[model samples]
Target: MNDFEFHLDQFMLHCDAKNLSRKTLKSYEQTLRLFQFFLENECKVTEIKDVKSWHIKKYISHLRDRGKYTVTANENTKVYNHPDKRIDLGREISDTTIANYLRNIKVFFNYLFQSGDISENPVKGIPVIKPKRKQKELLDPMEIKRLLSAMDVTKFHEYRLWLGVRLILDTGCRVGELLELKPQDLDLKYNAMLVRNPKNNKQRYVYFSKRMSNDLKRWLKYRDRFSDSEYLFPTIRGTKQNVSNFEKTLKNIGDSVGISVTPHQLRNNFAKYYLLNGGDMASLSRILGHSSIDVTMKAYLDFTDDQIRQKYQRHSPLDNLKL
Candidate 1:
């Protein structure tokens, strides 16, 4: 292999050794490979040492101009079944996606510099690309109630999905973490579940409500009669449910009920409602498994004017006074 390809492989090996999540590793590889391809073809610079800040800037410009799904690192794999292929091709890529690509590229170059493979980091001077924060659409109490009522709980699959929705809403746990849960992970006494496999690779406990606790108990008994899967929520064949499958299932259910829903949306709603109901930022940060309070604040602090007014009314000292 060429020097560039060799260095890329080495970087990936280092990431793998560090036990990075497969999703994270895949993102790194994809971003690096695309950048490598650009370097080789557009800039005609094959050597790792030859890449300059200008080349990196050129790449950023190219990315802004390039349409989505217009190119792939592996041309052969483009024919394979993929979600991106299903979408309309050649649309302008989003700024957020470009920012992610830049972050991944920075990480790769930083690794090389830290490992002493490079004399200087080309990405060191590159300014961090902050993606524009969009307002998160959250489910209202009435909409949530409507979603729950729409589920036909008599059917096993529907009942399982219903409980899954409730669990995420109650605990604010990720769908992936929820799927990884075994019965043993649950602490019924404390109304919490142990999230052994979180996105950041840090384990934390996510608590549910008393109402959720009772529902879980009922579901567990019902689940025992049907499947003996070790996973708390599994497919009909007793296998762990895929995240995409669960998302699609939830989407279809939402479509039927005339509302849009996804697993992440449920988690976001949990955070929003939690804050709306007098929950503090520090505790919310810990509960959401964020690395710091700043991250949590950046995410949930963009409250709309209506939401801010509601919070102000509820927390106003004079309004609560009996005098």
Candidate 2:
């Protein structure tokens, strides 16, 4: 193997040793392989030391020209037969995806530089890709009610599904973290649930409402009847619930209610509603397990005009002072 290939393998081993998730490792592998292909053919650079910042810029331009969803191996060849149907022929991929690829590449080069293998990081010179922010839609109270009503509680999994959605709406937990929840993590009496495996790898407690507390009690009793698994939400075989399956189930519920909803939408709804009801941003940030209040603001601060108007009416200094 070439120097680049050998170094790539070593980096991957290091990543694996660090216990990085399979998904992250796969991304690193794929991005490096694709870049290697580009370097060998387009830039005609056989050695890792020969690569420069300009070559990286050329690669970025090449990616932009290829458009979205269009994967090129060397420089001229385009890949088809991808799994996602929405990926059209030579469509321009979203900035978010391109940003992800760039970010992965940056990480790879940073690792090489940090390990003293590389003299300097070329990726450090490249500016970060800032994609246009998309506003997340919030589910109205009526839509939420209809979604819950759509759940067929008579069925086992559907009953579990109902409880899962309600819990997410109540606690604003990510579906992955929610699925990771164990029975012991639940403190129904205290109206709190503990998230052990959060995205940030930090454990935190998120509270539920009194009404949700009662619902949790009911779910616990019902869950004990069938599932002996450690997970609060387990599949039929009692394994931890899959994220895609849960998303699909949520999509089905959304279809029944004539609204497109997602697990994240439920979390967003919780945060938005919490803020609309005089909740503090700092507390909400902590509750949502955000890295910082700024991160929370960047994501959840995009309230609709009507929502802004309502918040203004309630909190307007003149109105509150009653001059």
For TM-score, the strongest prediction is 1
Model 2 weakest 10-residue run by lDDT: 74-83
* Candidate 1 clash pair list: none
Q: lDDT of each model, Cα atoms only? A: 0.88, 0.85
Candidate 1 residue lDDT tens string, 1-323: 89999999999999999999998999999988999999988989888888888899999999988888877888777667563756757788888989999999889889899999888899988997888888888788899999988889998888889999999899888899889899998989999889966456889888889999999999889999999999899888899999988999889989988999889889888899999999988998999888899999888787889999999999998878954
How close to the true structure is residue 283 of candidate 2, measured as C-alpha lDDT?
Answer: 98
Clashing residue pairs, backbone N/CA/C < 3 A, model 2: 67-92, 68-91, 68-92, 68-93
Candidate 2 Cα deviation (angstroms), residue 236: 0.8
Q: After superposition on all CA atoms, what RMSD does each candidate show versus the true structure?
A: 1.6, 3.4
Per-residue C-alpha lDDT of model 2 across residues 53-77, encoded as one tens digit per residue: 8888888788888765455433433
